[model samples]
Target: MTAWAVLAGVAARLCALGLTASAAWLIARAAERPDLSALGLAIVAVRAFASARGVFGYLERLAGHDAALGRAAGQRVRLYRALAHGPLPAGSRGAGSGGGEALTHMVADLDAGQDLRLRCALPAIVAGVAGTAAVAFCWALHPASGAVVAAGALAAGLAVPAAAAAAARRLGARLAGARAELAARVMDLTDGRADLVAFGALDFATAAAERQARRLARTERLSGGVSAAALAAGTAVQGLTALGVAWAAAGTGAVTCAVLVLTALVALDAVQPAIPAAQLWVELRPAAARVRRVVRADAALPPDERPHRPAVPGRVALRGVRVRYGDVPALDGVDLDLSPGRSVAVLGESGAGKSTLLAVLAGLVQPGEGLALLRPARGLYQDAHLFAATVRANLLMAKPDAGDAELRAVLDRVRLTGWLDALPEGLSTPVGAGGRGLAGGQRQRLLLARALLADPEVLLLDEPTEALDAATGRAVLAGVLRARHGRTTVVVTHREDALGLFDDIVVMARGRVELHDAGDRQPIGRAFPSA
Candidate 1:
């Protein structure tokens, strides 16, 4: 399809040149003879060229856009699949962090790649073909005139555009970076609007956003100036080429001279777009490089295969586990053993690696210097997401083949059955993206219900009830423990009041466990002196 588009584009440009030359020839001949009847052939030829130019131009656009959009769709799917199966960087757990920015930037890069094919490659190919044919046609009229046209075309189409691209490359990169920064800042401000207002930081965020916008505007203006100057230079070369052709064809027949001069002018039209095409090529170079890096990264990973199922349920052990974030250790020399039908609650201050421990158990983060043996586990984190879908649809993610009875059973286990049944839509109630339609406690309960529906051998909960009140948190925790009585469960929480709910409690400080108590009679605060 793309090849046909290019061919049609070249044919359209040639028709444009032919139309200009034929019209000039007919006018010159009519002026000499003052007889329109004798120029029937020329008149018919002019009409044919004019009509074909419009028709082929439309076809070229239709075919080119179809091909480009098709490729874009394929690229998006490939990129998404690669990211899904690939190993993500440490500390980037969800799209709320820098992952969203990275994905958005990659998408923009893919778009730029498509634009390169459509605006740069296609135009360059058509211009080269048409310009070559124009030079050959001019030579047939007069060799000296052909030499002048060839030299001018080369200067206008190649030299000027290349220089313009070089000049705009740095500015284009700056503009792209500024645009990305502005978008990130805007998103950050929007996401943290309440916190920013409460902390009196909204003004600072607005100022930062304004600065990025100004920088982008300035870079774009400079790039536009460079393109305009290059275009002017190309136009000047076209005018000089037309005059040279006319001078070289002196003393020839009026019709012949007119055809050569007009063809020279029209041929330059084919080359005029080359300057912008070159600029776009330069601008897309960084985007191309980014896309290449992502593709290479994806290729380096092995293809995803089905995971091996666990032989037995409710067993998780980590020996001498350690994880580092740069020079600092997040988890240091940690060892844990979870037996079947046992519940362990981890209590820690902020940054005490409680969440990291849950992540390791969930297979999200790899230990640097230890061995981990875990059964199939389902993790419910504070940031668990809910898509803009119905309640039934969201629960189905945990068990795709689940029926209405199974869905209701899990919701009932999580104590959400009453509230959900009261809704007019019941299971069909629509939840907004990230559970925006639900309250914080409702979202947490919904996530718990989904995890219960999965029926995993091990369950990892990190601050699962943080959004609920103390009474509700205890009730929810009790219900969750009751529902998963036979599974090995790990819960990370800061609530000392709920410590009695677990069979064992582990207190952590810095990156190591400070105390471990069994039988659930220990005071949680006494184990952590710093807290």
Candidate 2:
């Protein structure tokens, strides 16, 4: 596809050069009062070249955009897979993360990949081919004129573009930083709009956002000035080259001199895109780097390419596992083992590595030094995002082909049956971005419903009941355990009400297991009869 795009671009530029030279020859020859037949062929050549230029120009655009869009679709798929299944970069997990900033990186930064191909590589190749041909054609007719055209092409294509790229590199770093700060400020205002109003600080936050906007505008003005300078430089070279070619070919006939001068002018214009293309190439490098950091799983450590499944399904084992964030250890030298169909309740205080342990089991974090064997697992955390979509649409993410009955069943289990019936559109109701339209308890139950629908071999829950009252939390917890019977389940919680339902209890402190006990379990109906 790329090869076809380049071919069409070269053909279009050459036809444009042919049209200019033919028109110049016809005008000069007609001034000599010659017969009509003497100028017939030149007139025909002008018309044919004029028509071909537009045709090839259209083909060039069609082919180039087709190739670019096709590649973009494939790139989006790979990016989604990397974020969903592979190890994430540091500080990208847990509540209050900068999801808005990460979204900017995914969209704006990924676009840089497309620009590298469409804008930089395509334009550079087309300019080189067309510029060389123009110089050689003029040189064959008149050596002095050819030398003038070659010098002008080098100045416009090489020297001016090089200077533009250098200036852009210096300003591009500062521009990227400004854009990131602006995105963060805007997201905070949107997420905390209610609190800002309640505290009487809305005006202050708006002022800060306006300040960021003004700074971004100032940087953009500076970038525009650089582009204007490159444009002026290219124009100056075109005018000077026309004069030089005319002087060199003075001795030749008037008709030939006119053709040579016009050819040089049009050829210089054809390669003018080189200047901006070089600048854009320099500016897009930093954005491209951001995308690379997220897509590559081995950013911090070498990846273990071997499959990590245990000998039996729904079983997990970890020995001497350690994970460190910078100088601080999140999980240090932990050993654990769980058999299939066992339910374990993990109790810990804040900063006890409870969340990090869940991450390790879900395969989002790889142990820096140790052996970890696990099965496929699913986790339900408090911060799980709910996209701006319909209720049915959100549920379909877990099971794409799920029917209405299946969705209703899961919602009933999570105690959302009444809420669903109260909606104006029932299953088709639209939830605002991040579930802003729902109450805290409603959002928690919706996420729990999604987790129940997934039903993976191993279930991991991190403070799943933190948003509800004690009684409702107990009832919801019981329903989940009852549904997940005959599977491996791990609950990381501080509540004591659900302890009687688990077969084992584990206490953790300072990244180490402080206690472990194999206790007897009561029947689910006896413990939580109301469930």
Candidate 3:
């Protein structure tokens, strides 16, 4: 992929060089009467070279785009898998991350990086190579001409650009920082739009956007100012080169004059496309730093690649399992064993590490201190996501070949049969973005359906019914009751109403197990008459 990408960039540049040389050659011919056959043959040579260059240019773009998009896709998939190996904060990895929306990492940053790679660096590097060689060739034609070309090449491509780039760095960095803050703020505002509007902060969000726009404008001015300076420098050099070539040609005559000036003009113009790409290098550093931080973040994640899944006998045990974010331990010295065919409840207020514990259990977070053993379970996830795909597709995500009848049966068990039936496409109805979407309840149900489809022997439920209403929540709870069947289910929830459902309940406070007992409440007796 890297080879293909590099080649593509080189090809686009070859074409540009051929086009410049052809234009110069054609101008030289227009002034004289060369033989018809020789002129025709020369024209054919340039045209063929230009045509071949264009073909390679197209191929280069195709290959580069594929490489870039493929790399971005791989990065996203790796990120998603990495997220799977631990817990996503707030249960949903798609959104609510402090970094803002997943798109920031997945689309925006990736696109920016890829653009720099394909459109800027490769082409500039290619042209730099070709132009350097061309300048040397022109010098061999005339030593004085060679000296001028070399001087102009370094001055235009290196010296001026270096100085301008240094000047633009601070302005560019500030603008980049502003853009990042704006992107994060946009994500935050979008996530909390309802709260913002209800609290009458819509104006504030708008003003925030405006402020970002103003900063962006300032950056634009800075960039424009830099580019304009580059043009001025190039024009001044070209004008001076033309005068020098013309003055030196006074002894050599007009033909030599034309040749030197033409060479100078062609080589000077070669630096134009190169200038922006060179500038982009200066602009892309901060973004590169941001992406590097994300990539290197994984390096700090302790390798938890256990060669084999432990045959943990129908019970989960966290032996001194601890996890710290920065300096604060989210789960510290935690210990527990969740047994088979039983439901355990973990209760804690926000920031008491309820979600952190849940993440550890789900295998999404690595404990800073100890081992988290999942006993006889595939995995655990909270508020799991469904793609912008069909209801059937979402369910099939767990077990792709599980039959439509099987799907309907699970939906019926989850009490979502009516919901699916009401959909325009029934089981095939799309959900999530750009689809015949579901509400929060429906989305959660689809997630639940996905989990159940896995037929996990032990169920880990993290606030599964939080999105549902009183009656609906109860119905979902009843579904869990039926679904639990012989499987052990560990749940983290706050509602006192769910106390009856568990065979045994464990309450957690500040990463410590506070309550571990069978229910004393009569609701369990009524709900499970046989028990």
Candidate 4:
């Protein structure tokens, strides 16, 4: 995309043009048996041009790839930003949210976009300039030969490529979706391999993956066939052009005729890239369209124009809020208020809307009716992911600028101080993906440490101590509540050990609050409903 890369491409192409022309001239002129001294210049010229061609080509590749990669990096950032706000790419929501399908969009689709600039546009521009110059050079030698070369260049550079592009355009429409489907299928098999084996459904998943692969292969085969046809047509055109030039130059001397015909043949190289470039352009079109759809969809969403409700730090209020999924309500007519520097415990069985209430307060889910006002909030879900990185790296994700002391403090707050000191690399110790290397309790603690690092105005924890032993769970919860003292915190928990730490307790049933009690007034056992 950079001007320097384009210039380098042109220079490289011109060098190729010169190398072929000079070599042809040298061979033809040497046949006259002229003085060895005269032949010396041609020999030197041939070598010089040949070497310069490689040098310029290397430079072109270096500069071109650098430019393409840089542009792709920036485009990737834009794509992420768009995806973050946009309607997520297909298969990037709910179950398997970021599996193979999203990976295809992020990686393969972006690669196709980069190919548009690096392979399609750059080659086409260089080919046009160098091929035109070659045509002009031929015209200087003889008008008839020039006419023949121009026609051949047009056929090779435009006509054949155009035909290929037309065919590719239709196939490309299906190619992007097919690739994504295949990736999703493959990822499904991989991610669910253990479960599939356990359930004896591995063969079924494999069969499905094979079917997708076949579909994708069929589309690719068709595209490859088109490219092959275009390549053959371009080669035929090159041969015909060389014959025409030779015939047109028959009246001229043998040396001149040889030069004209050979130049015409070699010059076709400059135009040759157009065939592949056209096909590449066609392939890129679908990918570009998909990316644009994501970005445009985000743009189409109405801005958050809701007037701000007057609220202080950590204050949250929901007035007759309701949320539903089809016929089932997750939250219904729920009215509650959370003041600054207060803590609440939300207790309920499954499907009682405890988690949904936290979702509302965190602004992750919008209520279908009534008002829900909240300040900045962060939630530590039960399924928080720990990346396959160092302890420091994982913690830094919550607060990027956090120093060693800050990280240590958060770890201490979550009662991981002894564990942190035991690690061979201390903060630099690496953890496995999804916390594979760490115990269940340690993973939960590490995630809690990350959530607490930011010390948000409002903290929401959805069953944070679910994975720990009863004793450890109680201790960790106590430590977390102590650290979150004087801050608004809402915790979803079934455990009764940490009840006294909260200012209030909310008990819900069937999406409605059944009881609201001050923590100190009610017996912990009575707070929960009888079966």
Q: Which candidate is the best by TM-score?
A: 2
C-alpha TM-scores of all predictions: 0.61, 0.71, 0.59, 0.56
Per-residue lDDT over 108-189 for candidate 4, one digit per residue giving the tens place of the 0 to 100 score: 7778878888889999998998899889989998999999999999999999999999888878878878998999889879
- Can you give the lDDT of residue 323 in candidate 2? 88
lDDT of 1 by residue, 1-531 (tens): 389899899999999988998899899999998666789989999999999999999999998999988987887786675444332333332322323455777788889988988998899999999999999999988999999999988998999988988898777668778888989999879877889999999999999999888888888888888888999999999999999999999878888999999999988878988999999898786676666654454242233311123434566667898999889898999988777778889987788988888877665676788766654433333337787899999989878999999998888776788889888899999998788889888998998888878776677788888888888888889888988758777898877888888888888888887777786465666666432
lDDT of each: 0.80, 0.79, 0.66, 0.79
| Candidate 1 collision pairs | none
Q: Which TM-score value belongs to model 3?
A: 0.59
Error of 4 at 371 (Å): 19
Q: In candidate 2, what residue range of length 10 has the lowest lDDT sum?
A: 522-531
Q: Name the TM-score of candidate 4.
A: 0.56
Residue-level lDDT of model 3, residues 100-169, one tens digit each, is 2543553455566767776677666766775676577667667777677777777777777677777677
- Per candidate, the number of residue pairs that clash is 0, 0, 8, 0
Error of 2 at 194 (Å): 4.3
Q: Which lDDT tens digits does candidate 2 get at residues 1-531?
A: 488999999999999999999999999999998999999999999999999999988999899989987987777776665554333444432213433345656776678878877888789889989999999989998999999999999999889999999999877877888998999889879998899999999899999999999999999899899989998999999999999999999999899999999999988997888998999889776666656656564434334322232346677667788988889888888898877778888777777777888777665577888766654333323337788999988888778899999999999887889999999999999988778899988898888788788776677778778888988888888888888867788888776777887778777777877666675433322321121
RMSD of 3: 8.0
Q: What is the C-alpha RMSD of each candidate to the true structure, in Å?
A: 7.7, 6.6, 8.0, 8.7
Q: Which order, best to worst by lDDT?
A: 1, 2, 4, 3
